[model samples]
Target chain A: MTAEALTTILIAMLGGAIRVSTPFIFVALGETLTEKSGRINLGLEGNLVLGAMVAYAISFHTGSPWLGVLAAGFSGVFLGLMHGSICSLKKVNDIAVGIAMMSFGIGVAFFFGKPYIQPSAPRLESLPLGGWASNPALQQALEINPLFIVGILIAIVMWWALANTRVGLVVRMTGDSEPAARAMGINPIKVRILATAAGGFLAGIGGAFLSLSYPGSWNEGLSSGQGLMAVALVIFARWNPLRCILAALLFGAAGALGPALQSVGISQGYYFFNAAPYILTLFIMVAATGSNSARAAPGELSIAK
Target chain B: MAQAETSFATPPAYDTARIRASIEAVAIPLGALVASAIIFSVFLTLLGKSPLQFFELVWRGGFGSSFSLQNTLQRATPLILTGLAFAIPARIGLVMIGAEGALVIGGFAAAALAIPLVSAEAPVYLTMLLMVLIAMAAGGAWNAIAGWLKHSRGVNETISTLLLTYIAIAIMNFFVEGALRDPASQNKPSTMPIGKDYMVGNIPGTDVHWGLVFGLVLAVALQVLMSRTTFGFAARVTGGNPRAALAQGLPVGTLIVVCSAIAGACAGLAGYFEVAAIHGQANASLVAGYGFTGILVAFLARHNPLMIVPVAIMFGAIEASGGLIQRRMDMPDATALVLQGIIFVVLLASDSLYGRFAIFQPKISTERT
Candidate 1:
């Protein structure tokens, strides 16, 4: 291949990475928060789809993307509440309940979202980071969504708070040991529920981003299990909120490989490339799980050692 | 010899208290179903449809007529098998979400095997045997990946199995839509059909295939395997307390993998039936939510293989009636999914009732009595 073509492909790949990574960033952050609290919510995928549906419908009705985001977050909180409450009940397994909630949330989303599939919604716009560039490709590649930056900022804040703040310490203690948390006079259940709700909010926003931004459309097939993949991403990130952002971007890049390759007349093994993100996650999970220095996972987290 | 013979004899009578406890256990799921129906009724009202009419339609379309009953049974067959897939592994304390992957790969394997045998002079029974074996092997291997990860590397089975599912679906898509695509099926895009001669036969006096019988048989067999075997005892022990089982010198890792493989094999068999009896070939048509629905059935049945049979059929009837409800009531097809989801959550939450209910808790105030 010519250098010019190769460079174009590389640039397009970067652009695709950023575009796809936005949702991953939000979702991984959400999952990281939930995991840090020693409870894993696998139903984030449902939150994502429902959030997208709610966001799109609200945006279409109100002509405001921000409100749509809020609505999406609310829907996520609603799901998180259900998940947290059911899991808090004696004998109810959190992971299983998360799976159930996933199905339930998706059902509700599809049921309510039937009408919003065709309508256009006011979408969140990308910041013109490359406005001064003369090349169209360069400008397009540089146009980063604002949510990407917000996600990074949230990750940074979360990292700092987790290390220093009392609330963060409570969460850490609760996750490390329920007895320790109880000794400290903190309710582990409450902490987990709060963390789960916060995580759901972020995931819901991520879903909104998918519908109201890059993909810029609403459909049932819009989400291809990105929410579910985020759970693995959180673990791969070692439950670090900061690492979650980078991991999400990496996953986004992996997911975009097939489409980017397709755009440049390279269609061989597109399906395999499409499967890259899931394969990468499995590889990371195996590696992280076997590694001695994979970081000390939360004690109460079922996925954690 | 007299004492031994006396000990082997049947107990005097069925215990009324034990029977009542069993009935109470069932009440949780029943209550959840009723609650979900109420919640769904409100939803239907919001959508401008009558919940009564919806329920009536479900009854009418699912089991009112002989034709509908057959359709429900046909739908329930794979569900029963898949439910066993989930329920069996769940009994061993492994949440194997890779059944969808197993189903897809199994179906693909069935189709792949059939392609060669269709034109060959292979005997019909041999072809069927080859299909079942290949399908189960593919599925078993698929699930074994997650089991190995869990037992050897401490990776969580849930995430690993789920990720593998995506990879499995992608692999099948590549084969069916590209390499194995029949030139004639252009618009829908499917693998080559497995031909009428190689197809499974219908049960006597019914349009439904023999898979329903296969499902029922497997359920009963698994029930016996789980309740009456030493291996099942070890599996139960492992599930209840893995560390304790390890302390007892049980090969916990091997049991985990083997049990998971068996679970995957069950789902794979379901996939084989789908391809051989229903879809006629492996394609996107096999990607229906049978695997997911099976999870609910497993939960509703509390992961008992025998209970999975009835639970799966109930769900199957609900699913079969979904389209009819949509036509007659102007409700979305998602209505059925909503009900199923609600029932699943409620049933899971009902787990709390196990030790908390006084009916299940034996009375200790014998002195006062």
Candidate 2:
């Protein structure tokens, strides 16, 4: 409540927001792209867990964090390919397949990740953005990872590409109408598969950010459903790449609220604060659903169905 | 292509078509099971473990003896209940995965309620009955939130149910680790135990608790409710086409909400039994993934209440063998999880096979081939 306490809470929350939101940024962007291609991959949660574990184990064994990140992305691609291929089959439900992929991805991750839980892995470094600040706490809070910048840049690029590029047109066409796309000589299935795989690649990188940067460890509990939350974020963002960054930052702040409050010597309702993002997402969803039909969604997207 | 044209050229008899439909229902899921088993065996072999030995151990550890069968049955109890939870909503075209959350909240509610009553020396029968009712009510209400949202606002039920699960767990954690934490439960924060005097006893001749009986009775009752009643008819119509159901003047929203509540209640009862029969207290242990596993059970059963019992028991047997598999094969307990994941994926993918099978294609013409 005091000026100093408020400063402390603000600084801690800012730091936590930067730390926690990086994963959200990548996953939301990934989901945004996938949804734009008329598919929703709920297995991104599994992708996150497996990516975190794979990133950590690869980093631990190779002593190269970047390599681990790359491996994590590839692991996500593999899972994404599995999801895309299975879902492409006739009569299969996309949502149910997503659920299966989630379980499969998580199960495989846990099975291989058991041994890497205790060992420390090489981690990604951050640039001190607050180097000119006099306060050490402020300086620490300003340290930003390279991925944060990369996420922002990618968002801008995606926003531009989605609106301008020939590839973007094909993707949009396919998402809007499968028959139309087929008439235009674009195979909707292929486009969706590739888009899903690309989305998965981003989600994997997001997982790497968790283990290699902030939490910076390989563990089963490393992700708290950040992957799943990305769907909500994409919806909140109206499937815009640029808006995903804002949504991710907001979620990061919400996630950081509990820890930030605890840092300021206020520990009451910590669990409630911990659950803020889910509640917020649910509220936003309810609010969003009330205003729109499938108007904001891709015509061929199966989420509502 | 020519063979298919020839088969289709002549209309088939009604009896043959009926036989084909029946066979396909059994054959598809059965084939999926066999396919997943083969894939799992390949996975084990790649890991340098003998697939043959692993399965033999599973059989011996799960159902080889009376004790093992009872253990499997005990574990199956929760799956059966949770499967119904998923199955009921699925019948109404809703993907409700909040059963896990419902179970946790339901169980936690039961434990939290027991504190003052036990201290007040409430009669054992009254206390137990109250706990069961409280658990079911808690769970039912919890899941109903998602159902209501889907109908009222068009919120995606799958995502909503998933979010509710996390919220449910957080709510339970808030209580168990805070106001209701028993000082005696160090290292693992937990609620005050209901005590052995209030614990539900097992069947007279078996080690399995009364939850099994509850699951059996509920499964049969729900099967009838879903297949043989007007409510069931309305639900099936809604599931097939919500727009059609609405056009028919069916209460679509009510059916959706009712199915979700029943699903939640079933899951909640599983939670109550976990408290009253197994753990004796509510803690992090109550957060076990029984609710998630029940999804696989329901899927394997094709969301049929009657079929859920058998599928759940098989899954339970697989899980009951986890410890044995871990020890004998030097594999992690997640081996079972991996197998389940594979089965689930394969089963869902096998949906494409349903209409593809020539035998399963019903001939409405009813003419002799």
Candidate 1 wrongly placed segments (more than 4 Å): A290-294, B1-21, B46-48, B365-369
Q: Write the per-residue lDDT of candidate 1 for residues B163-206, one digit (tens) a residue.
A: 98899989988887677888898787778898988899999999
Highest TM-score scorer: 2
lDDT of 2 by residue, B1-369 (tens): 445545765343455677787788889999999999999999989989899998898899889999999999999999999999999999989888889999998998898889999989999999999999999999999999999999998999988998898898888878877888899999998999889998999999999999999999999999999999999999999999999999999999999999999999999999999999999999989888899999989999988899999998998899899999988888987788789899999999999998795556765333323
Evaluate residue B52 in candidate 2 and report its C-alpha lDDT on the 0 to 100 scale.
95
Model 2 regions lying over 4 Å from their true place: A290-294, B1-16, B364-369
RMSD vs true structure, all candidates: 3.4, 3.0
The two-chain DockQ for each candidate, comma-separated, is 0.84, 0.76
TM-score (chain A only) for the predictions, listed in order: 0.97, 0.97
Instruction: Give the 10-residue window scoring lowest on summed lDDT in candidate 1 chain B.
Output: B360-369
lDDT of all predictions, in order shown?
0.86, 0.90
lDDT of 2 at B72: 96
- Give Cα distance to truth, residue A159, candidate 1, Å: 1.7
- Per-residue error (Å), model 2, residue B196: 1.3
Query: What value does the lDDT take at residue B113 in candidate 2?
Result: 88
